[model samples]
Target: MIAKLTDIEALEAKGFDAAYPQKSPWDILRHQAETRPDKVAIRYLVDASDPARDEVVTYGDFARRIMGAAKLFRGLGVTPNASVAILAQHTPSAQTAIWGAQIAGRACPINPMLKPDHIAGLLDAANAKVAVIMGVNGELDYWSALVPALREAGVTIPLLACDADAQSPGADGVFEEMIQTASGKDVQPEGDETALAAFYHTGGTTGAPKLVQHMRLNEAHVARSCAIMHDLTERDVVVNGFPLFHVAGAFVYGLSTLSAGGTLIVPGRLGMRNAAFMGSIWQQVERYGVTILGVVPTILASLKATPIDADISSLRWLLTGGSPLPTELADAVEKHTSVPVRNILGMTECAGAIAVEPVHGTRTPMSCGLRMPFSEVAVFGETEGDADPSKPLGPDETGIIALRGPNVAAGYSDPARNIGTFLDGGWLVSGDLGMIDNEGRLFVTGRKKDVIIRGAHNIDPQMIEDALLAHPDVLTAAAVGMPDAYAGELPVVFAEMRQGSQAGEAELIDFLRDRIEDPVALPKRIGTVDEMPLTPVGKIFKPTLRAEAIRWAVGQAAEALGVEAEIAVDEKLSTRVMVPGESVDAMKDRLAGMPIKLSVEARS
Candidate 1:
């Protein structure tokens, strides 16, 4: 599974007769083209209302598109060391462009949701000489945002619009038109497995986004592992709902199915917000005979809310990630839909998901799953004053999760961030807290930064959240730490109730009191909300919760002191306080009296 040197040589001769057989991601489609040219490689839904409008492409056609893109890039002077940025939705041309860039140079997939200025900074960071993006529409104005970003960065890159609605104002050429005009003949098929092939930026939740460097083999290895876990075959049809910019969408759902010679289904530019498309998801699955489906917890919740009568007998399993799936919700979904839900755990640093529950294997409730065969996982902790901070913890002991594998990213763009990240044994610190159970199943407790310190005791918010989720009335729950004058920090729970369920704060509090025995771990306050703020990938946005808690704390302090105060918390958990008509020293003293450590800024 690690693809040793011996295995790489075997892969060339035994499997697929790959052109660039050092385990490059492109060889999957290449192999399929040779063996199954007439078979459907990609079946994309352009419009949900009309199934006849589905765009179908054969493996042979897909190969030609990839070659055409590669030819176009070479003509544009792209070299093996250069990089090309792609900022478009789910389309054959966009996907082909990614392969072409990887073959000729490096492919950088920028999240289209980012602001124009942020996109410009990333493009500058990657030094992209060319870009592919969607043109402006009534809904998405990607062209309008990208043009300014390119100009502001002082970059003169050629912009290729893949989804040009009307004639793009700044597009040098349309993607489809260029592919049709160019000859895909006489293209070189050279690839280096160790060479950097793609660059993905982190979510920047902790700080500014850092570029994650990935070699071709890293993606290929994980995709193979995913193929095995899903038990995919030529008979299987897989659908990807996640954006192509995400690792789950591109690598797990896209490349993995291709490796298995299975058809890949996509919904063009349709995301979780597309209510119409989402409403007809079951119908789409039945129409396509989709054997595998990828989703997140938020999407699952929405599907559960809006029930649709459709035959889902073809679905082998519901692969869910991007957030933790509560046991209660998982059971409810299975009971309602009769499809098993498998929880997966992964991060960008690992090139995508590193663990998944097997299709017909035993799954522990709320457990993320077992580590993939290609990766080495361990729980590590730091000891006070110990010279070596990367000491491994025993099983069932909570610590920072560490992983080392061929699937892991080579390193970050900034070498400084690489020091503490990679340990002496090549283990990459995951920054997530988890423990391995006796059965070797991985259980994610929470993020390292998400741990709440209540009167010097470490309290994991995930425990409280899980307890609340067990209640039948509770739909989705999130627990965070609220700054407290006495306890340093108190656990607070925010939940969204099931529709028509009349669960109040006191009722939830009493429910938790019966479930959680440890007082320190119990939520001090319970509040109900209509919905929880989620990240692009559908994970709970804890930073937003932390900021709201700080604001609430500041308001309470201001009311007590009869003065205005401003508060902010940064990624390092550093607190900043500003007070008008008060000395910095006086404010600091007052905060210190409340057992708080904060930097006081004087108001101008």
Candidate 2:
């Protein structure tokens, strides 16, 4: 029988998996290698140099590579429980490194896009002894300049480079080259299920990001639960484009596919410039007979805009998460693709997904669906004069959504962030606001945290706000999310300029571009406000600012289209523009290129 969230107890529960002893993620690979050595395990689609060729890795070869990397780790003096940080763009080699790190030591997948300072802070927090970084590529060279930057920040960890030049300093040979030469006989993992396996960094409410710790046991448990949820089998072909650093890329989608002995397909990183890859996604799905696909809302939007002519009858379901999926977009996808669209809800703290729309199940618009087996969810709220904010709220009452189960991370790396984030009963206090119906289905309303979900990446607006405040012309600044049709949300800033100083939107945007390494965090528009809404205690009233930002985005969109419409913005910032005597398709066509996303409806 498949395990349910209620069947599992706390992390400290004795003999937690006594009925079914957990297996290491490496063991899952070994079992598949032995059982189906010739079976194709991974296929890399859309090679930039050769678009026609796809690199395939069989189960046996995948296991051997992991074993070889394990031996290489042992040779480098990495012991069990040691932390190894990997910083590289999404690639087959990067995924191989993750498996190798877990077999020998703890794997910490650092975001490749982070600036050197942020990278240093993460490496320091993980206490990584060795860092594997991208080599001297044309772009995204994590080794060439990042090594010196990390060193300057007092991080003296040994460096391993992927595709590094032979003469590069601090490079202990190439990763692919060393792994091939190493013997695969001495691979030994001593950790049990509960032993720490990986450290994933996620944006916290604070200025600094928090390190989420997951155990091998958590991976095993989550994988099994997910396998059953998706009805995964050996015949299933799963495709994913999320980076391996993210939980879905590593555990929920990746490990779960392995757990069911299914073939996992890793496409190249998702970007607009890679039009060659993005445009041919449907053809790739047909070529591989892709049974299951995972995508963010932005990808769906792109696919809708550029229709691909390919037979997708083999596709069983298209799973979407990471950001809010619009009801209209979902309907459009289903109508075009003729595949069941399942919207899932998950977080890094929750290993991967805790809830998903069941196969052939009915769905409520914008609802994240029922909680999966073995995962417990509750709505926690506060009552007037109640000392405990952790009190469980009644059904249908909007409150903070708290989760508990084997899937949840053990705890955060920082003790300070751990406070109040975890309740007395081990329930993780998700910064999201939601409500559960009497039927136990969850409806996510909004986020209490100030972070914005920009496509696949979780952007911390405070990072940008802090940078804007340092500018001489900026007196006060607040960054918030503005609704977008393509990207779920775009970062927008509202700033009150100094009385005598002058700063325009373009100039401030240039200032932010120079300071912030991540362009996603940069504000799309900067509105000069007379005064920001402030609470009685002098804190910026962000809710009011967020509402204003959404309205402003809608107004701009309407003015650009030259359409007089009545617009209504929901709590999630989903806009509905009603234009008298205008057809939905025509209105949509007119507002196609607008920054804000609005659904065009005709008023009777």
Candidate 3:
């Protein structure tokens, strides 16, 4: 086994292909099955309420199941060029579908929480031959609602149900039954390093979804790199609650653990969404002797209130990503659990990893740690004349972060979407704004689009968020640009206070006055929410806040004109306000100076 990654340069010197010989995920699993067949590969909880109610799959059984899934898909007419779309929770069968589909064809795991039309769009985009959906299981009945919706959306592909119950209907076959009966003796992996392994949709709230094509080499390299970064081995047991559709679940936490022959314990069907599971997460860790705990920032934030009820000495590292890790939040988690929190920088285009804080390394204040082995991460100028990748900015110069490595995906499925991002020389231009420090650690500042433009000044919302998060009573904070008629846009903050903290918005605003450096960056207003809106993957949902900000701005503008305006924000976030014809001129005048385009309709 490769030594723990203390120095990235040393790992790169050994050469990526030479150090990690496993070319595909199947290769890794096959090696484990051959060497240690009886070792537990997966421990899936049947019910999150009771940790003891679980199912186990050994390495040998998992390998055979993967092969069986491949054979079953082949029997269903799946080809390497075609895809098997999966709309299910994280179950053993779902895991089988992911790996098996990859071996037989391509795996396309869709977010089951998405609307039917969106899911159908992804299916069409992937060129899917068959779909594996989660069957009815009590309150978790995605099969009951989704199957009909998919059919209504004109999805005619053959559907299979995983963990199907008697109440579940409309699927052509059962995933587990077919896999168990299929012959796995002669089935083999069909793809190679360059072959497409999966299609992961980018989580854009609007527009047509872009499917990132992960090559077999991309998955292999990332999984191996993550295993090395975390010092993962057969002894380690990771508890990964991330959904299958997300790269963090499949590659960062799921495959990385498997690649090292470690056991992966997945929470029940609801995964991290299961409130009962989250409440008893520490107990579950102790029950399973979980070593590596993977979570997003939102989950980390929520853990602050959850009392550690059991001995969690088994946990070595707490990994967080999918959003920026607030330094305060990291500090809080570390203090509470006595476990180091390692921040990760990843994206779907890179098969989940770009940079990961080494478990053995000292934690940097806000750094996402070193780049992946044999990968180049540089900060390029974002300006028009200086945006060339060849002219990367010097240390500490913040700009567009770009990556080039074997782990980077082979561009998006729609080639047109690759124009600005997938550039020449194998570089994937990440839209994120970041800086590589002198020590080679990466610090993501914010996204290019996330910058709030207040006339000529470009303000990063993170600066405001970081400032507000420093407050003791604030549990979560988000900064957004509130529409302003005079300044084009002004900074505003929304914060969720810790439980039992009576601190109000005015008190938080007063707290930020001294913390924020820039006068322009200081929030124009502060609002407190009982609970902050979060994405399924646990990132702060900024779009929802932005919509709320827009409504607040319209309300203020209409109030100035002495008119009641009804506001409507479409899926695209285009804001339209309607008022009486008499007040149209005054309302338009009030909102004229704002940069945001507003449709002011004069009601008859």
- Candidate 3, residues 447-519, lDDT tens digits: the string is 5547665532446687788878888988889988887654557889899988899887778888877665445
Model 1 misplaced regions, further than 4 Å: 1-22, 184-186, 189-191, 205-209, 384-390, 449-604
The whole-model lDDT of each prediction reads 0.72, 0.75, 0.82
Residues 99-152, candidate 2, lDDT per residue (tens digit)?
Answer: 888888888998776777777878877778787787776534557777787788
RMSD of each: 15.6, 3.9, 14.8
Provide the lowest-lDDT 10-residue window in model 3.
449-458
Which of the two, 1 or 2, has more TM-score?
2
Best by TM-score: 2
Highest lDDT model number: 3
In angstroms, give how far residue 31 of model 1 lies from its true place: 0.6
lDDT of 2 at 91: 62
Give the range where candidate 2 is weakest over 10 consecutive residues by summed lDDT.
3-12
**Model 2 misplaced stretches (Cα beyond 4 Å):** 1-23, 46-52, 138-143, 151-154, 163-170, 204-209, 269-273, 383-390, 559-562, 566-576, 588-604
C-alpha RMSD (angstroms) for model 1:
15.6
Candidate 2 collision pairs: 4-374, 5-373, 5-374, 5-375, 193-217
